[model samples]
Target chain A: MDTTVVNTGAEEKTWGGGNKPLNASYGKMMMWFFIVSDALTFSGFLAAYGFSRFKFIDYWPIADEVFTHVPFVHGNYPMIYVAFMTFILIMSSVTMVLAVDAGHHMNKAKVTLYMFLTIIGGLIFVGSQAWEWATFIKGDFGAVETRGGNILQFVDAEGKRVALSDFVVAGEHERVEHESKNGLWFVDEGTLPTYTMQEVITGFESHPDLAIRTQTINEQGHKTVLSREESIKQLKANGIGIVEGANLRHNEYGTPLFADFFFFITGFHGFHVFSGVVINIIIFFNVILGTYERRGSYEMVEKVGLYWHFVDLVWVFVFTFFYLV
Target chain B: MAHAHKLEILRGLIKFKSNTQKIWGVLILLSIITAVEVVLGIYKPESLMAHVLGMKALNWIFIILTIVKAYYITWDFMHMRDEKASLRRMVVWTAIFLIAYLLFILLQEGDYIESVYSSGFVKKDF
Candidate 1:
């Protein structure tokens, strides 16, 4: 006996395979899912940073004041360099889009060129960020950290920030940092600061033009500037040690938490950028190798383009929250 | 897959001949927005500093502009516009809802902490 199968097309439609539910390729869909999760992770970090800023609302360091350095010229041009960095990243996103368009058009030469431009843009951004981190670590105007963990910065009569090296008188005393190789078997202290507390105190006392500025913001939205007498008194009463730059434990800018968050968020973004550069480099060579051309589609270029664009998108938010805000 | 050549960026008010042109248009828009943001941040006009709904008007502007930039980057650069509606909803909606919920909870907690500190529960000065 021969069995007859039902010709119901409806059942076949219900169990159909190879149909993209989102109308996206498998790789593109997976990339979107990854982006969503990665976005959430970044949001969590940024929201936590917001929480800390709110906690010390009035005492938060001013972004313009903290990030005022340019590569070579640095005469208090606020937010200029960061603005340039943002522009560069956004331009890189443009190049990535162009590369995707070129891929769609099956123009191998254009794709290679655009991808090369994108890689260059990423390199410049990462290098600039590294320079920024270095400048932040080597603070311009040194401050004295209070015993209570607050920072007291120095200013001149006109309320301009004054460098510690400007007035700090070096003493004949030699400072030593403990190393593992040094006599102590288990005690290894970090590198010592350039200037000592005694030197700062002595220098501050002699410089009548210098005053102290607290981390607290005044009604005018600037750091509070104290009178000369109050400056000396406050420093003498609360100053415990000299803090020249930012670290995980100490921040000459303000609360150490700000520095901690800054390092973690920006460092994480930098790592993302680094990986994006590496991925772009790999894909660049692939485009030159005509791998995708032989495959008859340039979907791989589009996929990596999505990733590159996501990195730019994240940087936009990071720039807003960290620098502009 | 057949990709559309023309992109109606502003509901057909502005149209692009090709995808490359559309990308350039979006880039210009993004750059202009960034420039405006930078200028506002640097100057911080006093009138814009007036508190509106507990936040400065300037800050509100910055946040809104940033969202606009993010939207365009995701939609255009990432080609969310060309994707199927279902795919777009799945990716965009999930992120929107999750991020909103997370921000609400975190920001509320942060406001509470701010109130606690400002109300003198714990002296910050040591």
Candidate 2:
């Protein structure tokens, strides 16, 4: 006797049971949900940032002052560079939307082109973030100097802040002596960077004229507008290194927290964009080879389109919070 | 899962548009809104720039406009609006609840931390 077997798929069991109005696959719907959850996660991080801002309202670093440096420009520039980055990501989202449109029309070439542009846009945004990070970590106005071999900062005389460099002078670069390679105890054995924290300290000591400004001081503490006697006294004090977490406040270049979140969240998102690009390339090849035309539809593009747009949607919020707000 | 494939998906760009003109119209409107937001952010007009309800005014506007854009991206661009109400509800409602919960908890916690800070709980000077 012969038996007949039924191959009814999960779709039969109401992965979306009947009475479902829109038709979408389990995966696409799930993608949307994942994006929603992820969006909340990002918002959580940002909200925490805002809360932190309120706590540190007085000494919070000015965004414009901190982020004034621009590539290829000798002097300072405001948020122009990052603003351009925001535009790039948004435009890329538009292109992704258009790619999804092309997918709907069965226009593979247009989809591939738009997808490539989106990938390029993502790469540029990531690069901009990297540049911002480097500028931040290196810090403008340089590090401050302190009497206790620590660096410090404060609000300047003009009611604006200034770096310790405003008070101190950097010593000439000098190498510290260590035991010879053949006789030294193994101390990680790695080569040292040209400048060590110790070298920075020595530089501070040599420049005694640098004033000691506590991180607790306001912007009114750093300017040369003081009375002649006070200016000379400020000139006579030693400089200190910048305080810990000075690199992490809401400051001249926007908030360092802004940089931090922009990097972390956008980095995570960029990873998605990078991964999406790789997947799009794979899909592009299949489309080019007429795989979908033979199989009969281009729903894959639409599915990915949702992910692309979600990334863009998240960026809009990130951009607003970090740059605008 | 088969529908998950790009080849199997539908091109939704303007499939439901009453006309091509309407599609362009929506696109332009979205663009204008974005421009307004960007400009407002840069200039920080007094009317909309001050803090509202304790939060920064710019922040409020950004959050509101961002939510609006998210809605359009979902409903219009992604065509989630055309989806079954159950499906739409699952996505939209869950996000609404989750986001609301997240914002409330984090903001409150943040404020608590700020209060602690103001109370001199965490010493700034080393």
Candidate 3:
């Protein structure tokens, strides 16, 4: 059929370094493409979070109250702590960009300096997040009496969240006890707590002075809150631990859905920050080793730079929704 | 489009001043806004407590401001606005569809859960 055709270089190879469509290196282009996909993934997770939040609109637990712990401080502080964490992540991103600039100019010392700062910033941010998570898991004074398996909290005489034990006199009934796992749930030796829930209920029934009043219910039929005296009396009368999710009733905090979304969205974003830090470290090492300088291209640093910036980008959204909204 | 004065813009953006200045400025602004939001979240301002449009006024403010800030970070700080229109459209369309879908489904399900909660268990007491 005589279908043989001779190559004449008529159309140049549209890729490779010369005569390229974008005129950028493969590595940089790949990084950009990856960033686009990653951004979408994050957005999806965040949007899902938003949907759940909007669904539980009226009764979502307050974020500030829930996240009220800071590192190196013991007392109850509000969202001030997380606000600080957000700033740290954003600052680290700036440092990463500067390090990339240094790499572009073949300044190893400057690159190292900026990279070290960025790493420190990332570490601090991660540590802070861990501390916040620990506080959340342990929980504060749980709900003493719950309307919907949700916790009910009250301020004590000192206007502080008081444990159920604090109000009751010491020599009441025994507290809850658990058997050891060694035995079919071990009856391993341990002291039982004072004042069982039944005992507290009986105490309240017998003692008018110790009549309990819940945050939900007051002396009157109206939903009036109690004073410290009434609060103590109520706890003394009907001793019980904070709401501990007896059976799917709503707790003091918003729906369990709120907590679920909190862990998922923030957990995902934290993972991104963790990986972003690792990637930056790899780029930092390469810059120090003169990898890009030898190849006459610092695009490696730039690629990592884009990833770092994206992490910051995602955090801005996370901070807004999780912390503010 | 080619940069007619790219070098000038880059140089004029800052001289002796470092990039840290811009970073700090934006960061401080963000922090201030956060502080304001935190205050609102904690106190649940009485004015906001008064029901408006079937929700607390504070919630309305928080959601609105949060979206605005997110736009700034995405468009300006992240330089998404500087990208090709196709890239921007790809991101915008995906976000619009996915976010709206998620909201619709989850919210419907959540409201259903709330109904189950209110009706099934805690009804007699109230």
Candidate 4:
């Protein structure tokens, strides 16, 4: 008596177990879910960055000033190189979508070509990021860290940045960097900076055209540049250590927090790009071997394309928040 | 299966012949937006520097343009528009709501901390 089946047609409903309510395959839907969660992770990082930046609004380092170097050409070309990197990543996203479109059409040759191009574009972008990081670590102009944990840069009378090597005269005093072999058995000091505090102060005293630029931003939206007399006084009173480039512990640009966020956010994003490239390469070989072609659907390419485009999307935000805003 | 794409962007103001064409169209749009952002960032016009809603107008523009670019990348490149409405809302709405809420709370707290640092009796020298 209980064996009779009901004709309610539950399977025909959108929410029924057999129906694809989202009009997407299980694998595709899972990819989307992963992307959604990944997006949240990235937003968390960016939001934390914003919080730190807002906390130090008055002395936050300007993005334009921090990223000013080009590959070959130099001389204060701010935002140029980063703009180039953005374009490269966007162009690669285009190639990725095109690969997906070709996959939809089951066009093996086009997918291969476009996937190759996308991989190349990703490589170029990752290489550029590495170059940018190298340049940032190898700073051009050096500065001094005050006793109060603030940065003090140098500028000329015209308010142009001056490198420490330009005027710092080496002194006769000899000092050795602490090493594990010589100093405390377990404690070791970091690499010594190029110039000493005394050397910088002496050089700055002789150059009347030079000035001290503090990390504080004035009402005019620039670093507060002290006069010659004030520069001497501040350097003598507060200058405690020399800081030449950027590291996790210190930064010549401004607060150490700026470099920390820059490395963390961009480093995380760069790792994403790298893994995307590896995935693209794997799919590239699969396409070459006709794996998807034999499966009667190139959906594998589409899934990977979704991942690739997600990477590009994250870069767009990183570019805006880190570079533009 | 061949998927049909909604071959138009900008609320159908621009139409493309095919999905491939649409991809190129969105790329161009993204590029133009990026270029505009870079230009504004470089110049930082005195007019736009004025605070509009507790932020520089220029920064507001950059954030808005960035959202526009993100929309196209998701809608066009990721084929969000071709998917069913249920899927679309599931992905976009969730991320948007969560990120907005997080940003608001964090930024407000950060501003409060800044005020404390500037005005409170806590000694900064230490």
Candidate 5:
């Protein structure tokens, strides 16, 4: 009968709970733990990217030059679209927080609406990322790859970039298509670049105002621009072929590793956003069904909110590391 | 500790009436920081381009602003501000220490490789 006596101590009361650890729900605590591990994984990728960037410090591609294109626009607008993407993601994170707040208030309708907006934002971000990938793969100004595996770009006397189509003159040459009927059926030519090395060289020889821009970043943090004489000499001596856009083996931007890291990092992040959208849709339906209303708490929304916010946080770093720096 | 929320951000400089208001406040802060970053990146002022610790001064600004944004997103949007101290420390400290260590090792190796290319026998251009 005396066992009902008052008892209070840190050790006895601390580990007594089965669900709440440190006063946080088990799900929330687990989500935070998972996020820490995932953050390390992302940082590892980004750090390796940094290592490669530093290794090729002088010859690394200028991110502004590479990511200049905006969707449905023809002119050169550097970093504008990526900036828009970042804003959209941040807005989504805001909406996600709103949903979680509404959950705390037990407002099912508000939570549903905010969740819908967050889903829309996620979709837009994923789509924008896809468009960016396509634009990067289909490059702006084509460049020539040297025998030493270097990228050599073309520029006008004013230092504006010149596309291959602007200068490469077409020559009349009868060529057989590399079809399965002509060549080995098992292996066919993997599409040819618009212009050959000879055509580019010949075009360079004709254009007096054109010069070559090496991938090497000069003292002013711009690509090194060579004179007409040096351009012609370099092209004739080392130019092997033309690289139209980015691929695993070659990239018109600069080093192939640049394209490689860009693809891997952004692709991974896009995949996360894609899955986040899918999860949001599921949670949206659950909220519409009033599942949490019956359970008397909206802890599920809080859990997913953690994930969405984590995605946004990672993008903040990615945006800084890749685009700005 | 029991009933009231620990959600007020900015070290109590600007306390929010509700979590929704706090979310909007964070959004505005993040947007302003992003705007500053984009402007600095686009203009790349000559003074900010001066090298500092093997990186541009402007770049250092970007990284710092990025960390600030990350903090707001975590503390406010993710509700980490309301989290218990143990949980917060467990997540934040682990990430910070590990990422710092990783960056140190990887960057040092990268510098070594660069030295090899410049002063050592290895040549980059064939």
Candidate 6:
């Protein structure tokens, strides 16, 4: 096989196939194509989210209220932890670009250091996302699901949120959870909520200061709180079950769709971050072993850096649409 | 191959001494923009709550700032700016146009369904 390009007369034409029209290597161009397709995939998911949100535009769950937990501090601090996560991802992106820059200069030491930092940053971000998911699943103030599937939360006279434990008194009724082993072979039930509907209703009747806050948002952008009389009427007549946390079937937050989108989008993005970290580890070892040094080019590092930065880019959009917007 | 980077951002208004310096500079700019977004989200001023172009002015600000951040991340971190002009357009323009079209169709359909739910036989509350 002839290994050299023959000097064909067609080589001088603009339509010649021998030239690099895009001025990019094959690997880099393929990476760009992959990124573009992946971006469209993410855009599809985000647009679906926006559609759901717009459908429930009047009563969509407020992001600040839903994501108000910090790891150690107890008070309501919304958006702080998510902001921290965003900063970590952005800073890691900076380090990744620095790694690629060092690779350009052929400084093996700097590339190794920056790659290590980028991996650490990726780990921290993924861990934080896991923690966030856990916190979201374990809700704070429990709400009652009405027969109409509307969520009814408890609030004090001043409209401050009140936890079920603060007011609900457990009754003496014997309750048992159903299991596949104990119940019929094919039958089972989910975990029982901490407070039953009877307990919540009784508790509401006993506390005159408590009010019912519906999922509907008023013109003031706040949940509509009913008067004490209306609160009692709504609870006794409509309250069917207590929703303690979030799941695919039900959410103590406004709508179940909100929880579904939250899990799917963030879960997918977290999976990407996890894979990015794994790839960075592989590349980090290759850098240490001087694989690129022997190859006489650090283009592999540049390729992986493109992927790492793309992950960061997607997170920027995720952070905006989910948390900030 | 030694590659030369265009060492400026914001249409040459902000220049850096080197590629590494540019990376840090873009990082700072992104951080500041994120900070501003968080602050505005937390406070949610009354004046900004007024409707503008069928959405809240505050929300418009957020969306615009988000696009700005996306631009810097793509151009600087992903080295899209250094790519050939044809490749840049093929990647960036493709995503942008498709996303815009998708959002328009989906949101319009969503709004239409919402109106049906509000006024049509499908009752919102049982």
**What's each prediction's TM-score?**
0.94, 0.74, 0.72, 0.95, 0.94, 0.95
Q: Rank the candidates by TM-score, best first.
A: 6, 4, 1, 5, 2, 3
Question: What stretches of model 4 exceed 4 Å from their correct place?
Answer: A1-18, A177-183, B123-126
Is 2 or 5 the stronger prediction by TM-score? 5
**lDDT (10s digit) by residue, model 4, range B1-126:** 868889888888999998888888888899999999999999999999899978889989999999999999999999999999999999999999999999999999989888888796555431
Candidates 2 and 3: which is better by DockQ? 2
DockQ of each: 0.80, 0.36, 0.35, 0.77, 0.68, 0.83
Q: Count the backbone clashes (under 3 Å) in each candidate.
A: 0, 50, 19, 0, 0, 0
C-alpha local distance difference test of each model: 0.90, 0.60, 0.61, 0.91, 0.90, 0.91
Output per-candidate TM-scores for chain A, rounded to 2 decimals. Answer: 0.93, 0.70, 0.72, 0.93, 0.92, 0.93
**Largest DockQ belongs to which candidate?**
6
Best by lDDT: 4
Better of 2 and 4 by TM-score: 4
Model 3 lDDT, residue A49, Cα: 70
Candidate 3 chain B weakest ten by summed lDDT:
B1-10
Candidate 2 lDDT tens digits, A116-181:
887788778767777777777666654443453323443344445555454444456555556766
Candidate 5: tens digits of C-alpha lDDT, residues A240-283: 98998898899999999999999999999999999999999999
Runs in model 5 deviating more than 4 A are A1-19, A172-185, B1-4
The CAPRI class of candidate 1 is: medium
Runs off by more than 4 Å, candidate 2: A1-6, A9-22, A145-169, A178-262, B1-27, B46-49
How many residue-pair clashes does candidate 5 contain?
Answer: 0
Residue-by-residue lDDT tens digits, candidate 6, A25-101:
89989999999999998899899999999898887899999999888888989899999999999999999999999
Flag clash pairs in model 5.
Answer: none
Candidate 4 colliding pairs = none
* Candidate 3 structure quality by residue, lDDT tens digits, A1-325: 6577555455565543244344445665566677667777876777667666654444456666567776777877777787788778767876776676566566778888998899889988988877777767656644555334333454433445554454544354443455465455635554343445554444334433332224342222123346546655555544444443212233434456666776777788889889878887787788778787788766676677777777777777777677766
- Docking quality band of candidate 6, CAPRI definitions: high
